[model samples]
Target: MTDQWVSFSKVGDAELVSLTGEIDLANSGEIGKAIVGRIKESGKVLIDLTTVSFLDSAGVRLLDALVGDLLGHGARTRLVVGERGAARMTLTLCAFREDVLTTDLERAAADLK
Candidate 1:
């Protein structure tokens, strides 16, 4: 669809990155770059997927890779998902086992503590 969109904001000690539009092969690297750039600066990242309309395999791969990079750097990552569909499904299918991603911000923050 339209070019992929990602916006960033801060919530307490967490950095929230809100992603929109379709995430596919063409834009997944951009997404990764934006996120990694933020993590390099702050080392704490949260991905808010409340508005993501679609997600493809490349998107999932990017997310998975980012999670690994974040964890390897001793940074924290969280995922806040709204509603349920392909984006959530793809996340579950690709990134569920890492224990680095979470749907609840409070819980994630507590765990980080």
Candidate 2:
């Protein structure tokens, strides 16, 4: 269920979801679903993509939907994307909101406040 590619942790008051390796059509759905389940009961969430090696349209869509869902629930949420990662490049190309993207885990958690 994408366990090999996805991992979870607690970052301050935020539930952190980290991804490694590629996030393409084959595993994006599973990863997204799993993350949704994780943050459903959380008050804040952080999506960390610093270690993600690759991303595609599916991954972008998943992030969009995830952020939308979290916002809808009034949950504080942020994304952790290193300045030079594939995930960051893809998200930038897709015009993903910069207000939600950051490069530090602690900063992301602080932003949730």
- What Cα-based lDDT does every candidate model obtain? 0.73, 0.89
TM-scores of all predicted structures: 0.80, 0.95
**lDDT of each residue in 1-113, candidate 1, tens digit only:** 22348877787777777788788898898788877776675667787766778899898787778767777887777776644766777887764654665556566666655
Clashing pairs in 1: none
Looking at candidate 1, what is the lDDT of residue 101?
55
lDDT for residue 58 in candidate 2, whole number 0-100: 96
Off by over 4 Å in 1: 1-4, 104-113
Residue lDDT tens for model 2, 4-29:
89899997777989899999999988
Task: Quote model 1's TM-score.
Answer: 0.80
Q: Which ten contiguous residues of candidate 1 have the minimum total lDDT?
A: 95-104
| Top candidate when judged by TM-score against the true structure | 2
